[model samples]
Target: MQQLQILSGSWEQFAQDAKLIREQVFIQEQQIAAEDEWDSEDAVSLHFIAYDQGQAIATARLLENNSIGRVAVLKEYRGQGVGRVLMQSIIQLAQQQGRSFVKLSSQVHALPFYASLGFIAEGEEYLDCGIPHMDMRLCF
Candidate 1:
């Protein structure tokens, strides 16, 4: 419930905070393998971080091809609009860049949440790092 500040920057700039959030949410909580959690794309992706009480509580990234990924929020902060805020920030950034569409592979459990933001689910569900997910897209 602390004041939330959302920031957009290069992965290099927010690497420590971003990685900490992802490590806690995806690796520690979700049991995702450390090897799968870290990736080479961070060097090139546009990153966003949500800070509450000066702590990085959530993080997401936008790829050059208009795909959003690595959306992670700390466990205690889930269901508090942090994820929506992060997604909206990415969507706004996409709009600013004149992107025609944005896409993501959303975990099945979070499908409804993404749907509420106007992202339509597509294709059959598949596993990503042992988690069921489906491709979702929102077209401008």
Candidate 2:
């Protein structure tokens, strides 16, 4: 595996790289519709992209509301701790910004992953883009 580097910036700075990762993970692998995956929030949200040897492999975004979303890791990179590191960076950024907490809509299957990071499940599972998800929050 190549050395992993995560870069955070505006949509314009990271859009191309972020979209490529999201397209592979969410659009092709998960079969999520393009319409459902892309959103207006992207333009205003802070984006994080994980790159390996300069190739984008994972992505996530932190919205102005202190909500995290659009987390995606390529199939080849799953279970490699890339996602965890990416999320940790986002959480730290939230703390640096003086946020009380950060919330996310975690896919049901990934609940344990987020839980291991200190996120607590908040409500009953619901379908988002046809996938089971539940709200989770991590307080600083």
Could you tell me which residue pairs clash in candidate 2? none
Write one digit per residue (lDDT tens) for candidate 1, span 1-140. Answer: 76688999897799999989988889889999999988888999999999988888999999898889999999889989998888998898899999999999999999999999999999999999989999999999
How many residue pairs clash (N, CA or C atoms closer than 3 angstroms) in each of the candidate models, in the order given?
0, 0
Error at 7, model 1, angstroms: 0.6
**What overall lDDT goes with each candidate model?**
0.92, 0.94
- Candidate 1: regions farther than 4 A off: none
Report clash pairs, candidate 1. none
- After superposing candidate 2 on the true structure, give the runs of residues whose Cα lies further than 4 Å from its correct spot: none
Winner by lDDT: 2
